[model samples]
Target: MNIDPHKLTPRARNALSRAGLLGQSTRVYELVQSGEICYLSNIGTKTYRELCRYFGVRCDGKYPARRFKPVNAVYLKQCIHYLRGHGYTVIEPSQSHNQ
Candidate 1:
């Protein structure tokens, strides 16, 4: 699968920025270190589902689905950890080192 940076919507971009993940690859890892997120081993690429569950959203899909609106910041942090444990590495912002 290929990921296109340009395909990311403005909202997604803003979310990434707020999470301090903008223009970086290790942001997910950083979020984990911050104690703002947790990882679950069975979700696979459905990290979003884990987040939705965290927010108490229920799914009506046959395969067990959940929906979350506007995506919560705290949930996104959880997603970062989920992604990291699944072999996705996030890039930390350069300035994060000084702080």
Candidate 2:
């Protein structure tokens, strides 16, 4: 479980850095349709794992899905904050929903 920080991608490194910042950080986790269902893009394994751990959600393969959104809704925006903070482009639904 000891991942070399330098070995990770910049996005993953950034995600680890923001692990503590997500608590109580609401920033609107948006939705993007991909493959069959909506999923979070630009999020590496480390980022996804960190988010799930912080949100108290199990890694059931649904963190980025529309169903498992916003860490249980109620406007607890955290994913978007991380995504935006990293300056990753948001997958626009209008542009390509089923791509």
Candidate of highest lDDT: 2
lDDT of each: 0.40, 0.42
lDDT of 1 by residue, 31-54 (tens): 333323223222222443343333
Task: Spell out the clash pairs found in candidate 1.
Answer: 25-90, 25-91, 26-90, 26-91, 27-90, 27-91, 59-65
Number of the top-ranking candidate, with TM-score as the measure: 2
Clashes of 2: 1
Number of backbone collisions per candidate: 7, 1
